[model samples]
Target: MGPVNKNTFDIGPALHRAILGAGGHDVAISDSMLASNGAASTREAKAFIADARDAGQTPLKASEVEQIHAMPDKAAAKLVALQIDLDPARSEMVAIAQIEGVWCRAMIDNVPLDARLPIYDFKTCENASPEACQKTILNYGYDVQAEHYRQVWQAATGEDRVFRFVFQEKTAPHEVCVIELGAGTLLIAGKKIARAREMWDKCMQANQWPGYPLGVKRVDPANWAIERWPKR
Candidate 1:
């Protein structure tokens, strides 16, 4: 939760910050303050932070280690069902690129073969069905994430790659599904990224950061609300 470091922008959070109309400076300051204050709320969190500071691999908490040891062998089976390759090297690959006058970096969850090929992101959620997962993706800006990663990879290698999400339920009877973005959704994501970048660039150039709009906005009732309580 360090400062936003306006000099370097991470595509994922930058898009979100811009979309929410949050000024980069304020967001950076706020995040840093929060991180500073909340760094040691839990023993596990403190240990992880210490490991990160020491440049060593962070160890899982004792409880987490125990859980992992006790868990059934379901992950491998689920991946096999999803047709995902079991290459350890493919997991947690970092990609870096400079796009739209900003440095961007992404840690791809998995890439089966060549670095320029298709990428897969693993997500554990409540529902793995396409309809439910699509809603979750949009609500969580995963579409923007797909486009951001795609742009970063393309910028680095000059080749576009397919991005897919491998979603599975967090509970028992873990249902799994692989999802790819539709052309329409990708188009919308591209537009969103463009708008976010535009907003960021404008704010950077002006050297002035503004918060939410200055004037009061009108609030209107929705059709459902009107139907439920019609004016007499």
Candidate 2:
């Protein structure tokens, strides 16, 4: 990886560190990065970046720190109930191995200590409510991600493991919700993953990664838009 790029203030990653004990992955936050009410900074920002890089620390703004500390305890409580823990040393386990000659890897956010429990991965999002996250899951193809990760587990253990996501809010209150995809959603996502794998294998065999169609493409309006036109 090249030199780490600075995010504007870098709130999300600092938040992740505080919540998940995911260390050494977040970029360093700078002084000007936190100043001016989260505005972009000048030379001071660059100086802070240099300093943070040398020191290997990303200090969160006091306000940002407050938000992280204020995250509801119920989140941790929920993890405990799920047979997972917030302690990284004890729980942060990663599976990296080959799944039938395909090198696969997955960082388990909170490894289930109990054999009966499902696999859990944590996500920080704008909203942790099921109503909001259901859309997020589908729109972002998280169902496919879950299926893929499950395959990783299967490759390691020779058994199918149920996968789940633990979503926590980034903003105030920092509500948390744990969710598992329904069978139907997983089925559709699994089909998609299988199709993608087949395509990838074919591409590798052909040694030709094709791009867009070799022709001028015409854009068309949606069928609903055509129907909305007044029938004349």
Candidate 3:
């Protein structure tokens, strides 16, 4: 119900994005404001959950929630399998990968196994196309985000991995497009790490609040790009 332990590991494309944004730029909000905002969002989410229960939706029991919390390695298992196309027999044992020198505290599926691949992050829009997704990496400077995750994934899994972003429309599923790393994907992880380090250093000096600098990319301009990846 309450925000899970802050220390609980959650590393995906978005989380990496948040960390980069938080560490890099001087955010408008102060640390205290950010904490308060987190608390409010938690409360609102709980209220929404309670409302769902009142509406006769199957309410989540404490044990069910605990069970979900208890099994955190499923994501690792699923991502390694999905991204690498690694079947259990052809490759080394699938194990959960660690980032920030810590493994994720969430599961990919019901079965608990180590996930050895980095996941692509996609925020879908209703009208996204594959081409648009690719462009997002170029236009928005998400190259850094994808590169950082790739490095962490590779370190944990000993395999090359990529994280992608997708923005889609809420009303139209067909409008979704993905954002992926391009030429920069081949660069050493140290590059993004160093960039993040610089951004973080700047933030620390500026007394800035930390979070991802999420810029909403309008679908209007990406129409041409989306057309390039039109559904078959």
Candidate 4:
């Protein structure tokens, strides 16, 4: 109803476009946004065990919602196999805090076992193998996300917390994997966050919004593309 600040740097969209390229995956922004919204809504619905009840909260079409709800049973079972609880006390909790003069927010997917232990964030993807999920994390700038959440949690509660990702496949025979970021990974992520924050601060101060880098750039063909070329 009121004026919305359109200039805010949302990590999800910013990182997705930056790292994955606007059209790299043949995914348009509108389509990607819709998928993201649906996924978030599904997570919330599953968290509350209200998938059967129509909450009328998601922007996704009714059919889409039903589809996700139906497919999650296998994935849900995988979570149970791991003994991970989704409805932990602080699940789907939102927290906002100021870090280095930037307002940061995080919605924790779940806090299993005890709150003091590691926090878990659920991710539905094409593959749930540790190797595949690790690639997804890097390709999607999830490292930045890990650092951002860690900083926000510490800022809000003065206690450091470990961040973990629970990845599940979106297709049938839904597999799941739990990934814990080690100390070395977090250290690398911290540097990335600092660099991104610096760029954000500069843009905010200068009131200049720039898109992709300027000037002509050389593009290399993918290895598969090169392989497809004539065998000369």
Candidate 5:
């Protein structure tokens, strides 16, 4: 439901035509294995498939398609087990708000209008285990994203809501992990957001954007980094 590759978008209807139905969308079996060359039905089917693309239709193939299809199974194993249905309109909920007079927007992955559930944001990655995700969380500043989404949601709905990240692996196995921030992490995130907001406000007021720091500063590597580097 989040921003997936372009192939995923058009593949849905194609699969529906090829396989009768895939991911609840119709993709007719497009592979013409039985219809011999120069056969009238084969020509018609090919024409129809093209027309479907032009008019929009489903038929599903390619090893790439297999990999893409595999993704839903893994994702569903987790989300379905948790009773989460990412139906359209419910997924990709856009929330916009004005924070400290600065406009902000959030494209939330899933928000159940009918039930009480923590807001869920999705991320595709190389690993979804807790340990792997912890490093990723910090490296990618997902904590900041969680805090930002929370702020935007609060501003729009006037309700304080919990946030969760649904991290799914991009490769084989496609493992998934659902994570929530602890109190300490949330506190840290709040501070980071505040600092960023202050910087944004200042930039807006001055109408001057900045690149890297103009001031000359010393650079030093951490002990761990120094130790990790190989000796030549």
Candidate 6:
């Protein structure tokens, strides 16, 4: 569907992988647990790390620092703009957008739909440090949260979206920047929702969830839609 919807799907796993991959440890808690108990998991761990990093409590890792070098240059510049846009004084509730579902599970299916507004997602350079992000916008770690929320939003509402991955760079004590991913849209939401439904139906028909890795589950659109069906 749209950028917002597609991003929602990727946010969870992407954030999980980023933390473990960057920190060299598993920081995510099981989503299943979060729903059952009021306990923290990897998602909470990442948020805690982001806040702690911003506060300058935990030290930055060398690998994280090096990862900054790999981000696209343009994405870095856009991040600056995004930070400025969201930095103005406003109500805390309005400033902090509440992301919808994805609270039930960590895995997300790529779905595409159309939307009225384009949702922007920002990711920090591995080495950019927490201080650098605060100087610009909210911590880049929120990128995962943004994406995950968008996914649920798409499911609830069929709308297309543009997922922009703004990459930030650290220049000095009070300066940071961002760039956008070159990809047009992350995924089409309508297509994804249809796919998820198809798979769910198949699972019910066969009495088992189809075996596929994460987003790779094959769903036949013809089963759900009329006219042109997606060829698999």
Global lDDT of each model? Answer: 0.63, 0.71, 0.42, 0.63, 0.70, 0.37
Q: Rank candidates by TM-score, best first.
A: 2, 5, 1, 4, 3, 6
Tens-place lDDT per residue, model 1, 2-27, is 53323221223322222222213111
Compose the digit string of candidate 6's lDDT tens values, residues 8-106.
112222332332223223233335434234343347545654554455333223333334333322333444455423221210111222222212232
- Off-target runs (Cα >4 Å) in candidate 2 are 1-6, 22-40, 54-56, 72-74, 77-87, 90-92, 224-232
In lDDT terms, how accurate is model 1? 0.63
User: Could you give candidate 5's per-residue lDDT for residues 1-232 as a string of tens digits?
Assistant: 5432334225533322222112443344444532654232566565655554554444343443675577667877787798766654566678999988878899877766754568877777788899988899999899999999889888998868788887777678878898888878889999999889889999989999999978889989989888889763
Error of 2 at 5 (Å): 3.1
Q: Worst lDDT window (10 residues) for model 3? A: 21-30
Among all windows of ten consecutive residues in candidate 6, which has the lowest summed lDDT? 87-96
TM-score of each: 0.66, 0.79, 0.36, 0.64, 0.70, 0.30
Clashes of each: 0, 0, 33, 0, 21, 45
Note the residue pairs that clash in candidate 1. Answer: none
- Candidate 2 or 4, higher TM-score? 2
Off by over 4 Å in 6: 1-59, 62-84, 87-117, 124-151, 154-162, 169-189, 204-207, 212-232
| Model 5 TM-score (2 dp) | 0.70
| Top TM-score hit | 2
lDDT of 2 by residue, 127-166 (tens): 8889999999998998988888787777776657778888
Relative to the true structure, candidate 2 has a C-alpha RMSD (angstroms) of: 3.7
Identify the superior model by TM-score, candidate 4 or candidate 6: 4
Report lDDT (Cα) of residue 57, candidate 6. 39
